[model samples]
Target: MSNHEGTKGNLLAFLPLIVFVVLFIGSGMLTNDFSTMPLNVAILIASAIALLMNRKETFSKKVDVFTKSAGHPNIILMAVIFILAGAFAGVAKGMGAVESTVNLGLSLLPANLLMVGLFVIGCFISISMGTSMGTIVALAPIGVGIAGQTEIPVALAMATIVGGAMFGDNLSMISDTTIAAVRTQHTKMKDKFKVNFLIVLPAALITLVILGVLTRGNAVELAGDYPYDWVKILPYLGVLVAALAGTHVLVVLVGGTIFAGVIGLLDGSYQMSSLLQATAEGIMTMEDLAIVSILIGGIIGIIQYNGGIDYLLRMITRNIKSKKGAEFGIAGLVSAADIATANNTIAIIITGPLAKSIADEYGVDPRKSASLLDTFAGCWQGILPYGAQLLAAAGLAAISPVSIMLYSFYPVLMGICCVIAILIGYPKFKRTDDASASISK
Candidate 1:
């Protein structure tokens, strides 16, 4: 009864966010271009609504709440990562690393297996880099080029890259999602990774097979000089090695950018001015996303302060009677958070603490709860046509993010696999720490 009563005001607190999503989606539908809606603008207006709704607090105090949330440490870290990712992508392209790397991959795969190879490479690169955006930035352009060369739908190629990126985002030990999930649930990264990998491996294998079969009828062939420059790829290779060796992503990206810039300069592939310009351009490209991220953070913080999320927690878990219900609740919370923020890492961070509480109450394995949060969040990230993975991939490929939805089977399959994991409790493990509900595979 208390939960039922708590939900009443809480539902109203979240209305502003609902309005924002409606306006954004409505404007897109009116324009027939989903990407036409300025997400930051919608957020700003909704933030204003959130302020108006917070009548209990003084306006000044509400503004303070908004400001603190917007500038939170997690948001700041994400902003920094965005800037470096953009710079690395731009400078590497300026240095011919993209072309060289794509050619290298093409050189290794037959025409019919191009999509399969690209998806596999995306998996490896994302796992190594511990970032889906970084992998997408590095690989989507190549996927686009492959589509152009082979007369395939550009959407299919980009979907392959985006799908594989999500895979690693959920499973990579060094990924921010992994770190956030593990820390929040008080589980080890290896434990989460092991459980996560086992749950999602079949989804990946099926995706590979689907891509291979789809591309098998390709009558078109890869074109161009197919130039090979091992030197240009060294920066990417070095970054991969550093990431897999457990180096921080920011350090790996910054070092990789400088390495690519130097190689470009030494090899006469880029002028000093051109390299700087490329870096600047790359940073500029990420401005929209960066700003949107901050606004979402502020809006979410305000909502939470006003009792929106707590309301959700009570409402969603009011009837959770078993471990399965708890798992779904955990997954649902993060998925909702991801949909609201359009960022999986932020989603996990926002829901993780509450998820931990729920896990403890229901005796759900921490490893499984962490995996559920990561997997569900990762799934939504892929399917959200306006989310970072799709938007970034679309921007790089020069295509519509919506088109990729038709071909993005991997994330959908991944989501299904996670649901199956919840139902069957596959890859079962014994709990190690009775206190924290630690699990051993």
Candidate 2:
């Protein structure tokens, strides 16, 4: 084949991804409900399609390719981390840790600043616990309660909680999105956090001000006292502190799980058998996501082997001549993936390799690239009506997801902040090559 023909043929490798997006989005739009089309099913069909293409390879050879990629060391390591994180979250929640943490934050709120309090508390809890869903589930009802008692809008309050959740989800060390980003880019979690934090801090502060002004004089009358046990808050605090101190992620997760489980046992909140059960349930919750990660690895492996990635990189970077353009390209790519999938973590997983290639080619810092991937994904996921965070909050508040989406100020501002960062090259940091050369000197 001529070189031109070979390049064109490689472009066809993207066909499976195109088909998956069409089927997933098409079915969701037709049904007006995304739940009917399981993500795994769409991906499975796409995986089969990927295998079916590249006809020159024998069936057995293709299968071998799929299996090897599925079990790639990085993918396996990520899966194991997912399981550990699930176990830790499960055990902590089972011991009433979430409730205690929520209550502790609520107990400190000034009556008139109920809205602001929810946002701040959501940030703290989500950052500590490393799951926006958990934070939303714990805070959304309180937001609803505050709305009922004051002139605050339910949608506004719910949006505040979600905005806060996204803030922490973007920065949290133990978050799966963070894990995927850091692992894929081969950067440290703490390093990524530093980059991500500087980019989003202004947005978070601005959102806080907006929430404060919006809820000013909307004093909430207490219906009941929020009770909390200090002991139940220890695990989350420990985990957060250790993560910030630059401890290895695996050690933080395993130690956090054991600490939470031991506390539960000592407090009579869990029997020994119940601790084991909670651990199992948590691991089970992450099974679907872990499997999806492996599947994506396999599919992407095939596509890359077929030169789809090279073709894609060529097209995307063909006109990019500067580092800022490269950063924007990475941001746009991940944001698009998030929009198509409606899941930030999955979007990061899918876009990570592509983003890494771009970063390496353009001399973009890994930390900056990781930050862009996580921040952009969170920005879109925060406001998507079909996204889990908004949906959960809307359902709990008994309002439309669009209503909450309209008021998700933090996410909107977060995206803008990211853009500004890229435009001006904010939070300047040493790239890997620069650091290595300095050390060698």
Candidate 3:
């Protein structure tokens, strides 16, 4: 069979991916707990399956393919970023940066704007912290309290928080989802952010308008004090500024961690000893994710070596006759993976290579492909009832995930805007030698 045609002989090449989905999702379905099956373990099992598939190749040769892919520079760099991001988040939260940031945003907004305030704050905190679960945990109780104090539905308040968290998860330079998308697509963070921000900005604004209408006439005399220290928030702001200025991601993360640690020490939030422990704890938190990325890389490497990627690409791009179709295909591919895994970052890591191949083959912009991968994955991950974001928010609010899903407007709108972006070819970029070339100029 010709390489372009991706003949039936390659069909079995997809079995490992299918097995992974079944092991992960199927176990979740049977146990009623997605967490029961760790992602890395599932990927490991699938990697084994992939290794055993191409029997014609010697076992040592197959191991080389797997190890080579796992050890690829991009994969290693992504793992390092994960480590740095974990440290920065841990240090910032340990030093009361999160509390102060949340308090500041809450204190500045009036009672009637509580819902909108939560949304905006969720966006800021998630973008800085780079985790939707963390943002939801930080804000869900407050959202429930707002719902109780006002006429707005509890589900609606929670939805706003989820939506805003997703908004940031898609655009944040520090977000794992964004990191995975950018690295996998070989696009710069700022370039992906520029593309992603334009697509999701309209969704955010429309969500604000919707929340405003819901919050109208729901004003309450807020009864609690929200104390904040301005100095503590500078780490988040500084990191954000540095990222926007296009500083190297490593420098941005390391600077943010150091800045947060210094602030914490100065404020007596923690001593040097405590800061060190916090950083260690933060890095520990990312161990699972780093391992998962490496395993997925190996699994993909083996799959690609066996022609699975070619088969999948052929199946996806078969009907595509234009760049728009290819963009939609990329979006659909990542969205499906997100749905299967219920994890956006993992979905990006899994689909990124194939998406890049599609982009290269179809002339779709890498920035746009990265944006679609993140945005669409965020879209699915945000609304999935079994997904961490809704489950965390629901558990915090003592409500069902479906309740929040009913009002989760931002993700739905984000998906719609992604479709519209493709249809209209919005946020056009130049095709040049440099993938990160300045598109604005």
Best by lDDT: 1
- How many clashes in each candidate? 0, 0, 0
lDDT of each: 0.81, 0.78, 0.78
- Give one digit per residue, the lDDT tens place, for model 3 in 1-441: 122333532667668878887887688778876667776688788888978987778999889988998787766765676667678877888987777775665577776687877888889877876767556654665576567656778889889999988988788878888999989998899988888888889999999988888787877666788787889878877876776565666887799899999988988999999999999988886666667667666766776677764555566657877788889999988886676455688678878998898888998888999999999999998897656677556655656566688899899999999999999898867667876766642
Rank by TM-score, highest first.
1, 2, 3
TM-score winner, 2 or 3: 2
In angstroms, the error of model 3 at 102 is 1.5
For candidate 3, the per-residue lDDT at 277 reads 99
Better of 1 and 3 by TM-score: 1
How good is model 3 by TM-score? 0.64
What 10-residue stretch in candidate 1 is worst by lDDT? Answer: 1-10
Worst 10 residues of 3 by lDDT: 1-10
Q: What TM-score would each prediction reach against the true structure?
A: 0.86, 0.65, 0.64
For candidate 1, the clash count comes to 0
lDDT measured at residue 75 in model 3 versus the true structure, 0 to 100: 67
Superposed Cα deviation of residue 343, candidate 1 (Å): 3.8
| Model 3 bad stretches (over 4 Å) | 1-9, 110-202, 209-221, 320-412, 418-441
Per-residue accuracy of model 2 over 66-117 as CA lDDT, tens digit each: 7887787766765666667678777888998877775665577776677777
lDDT of 1 by residue, 289-356 (tens): 67766776787778777777666666777778888899999988898778766779988987899999
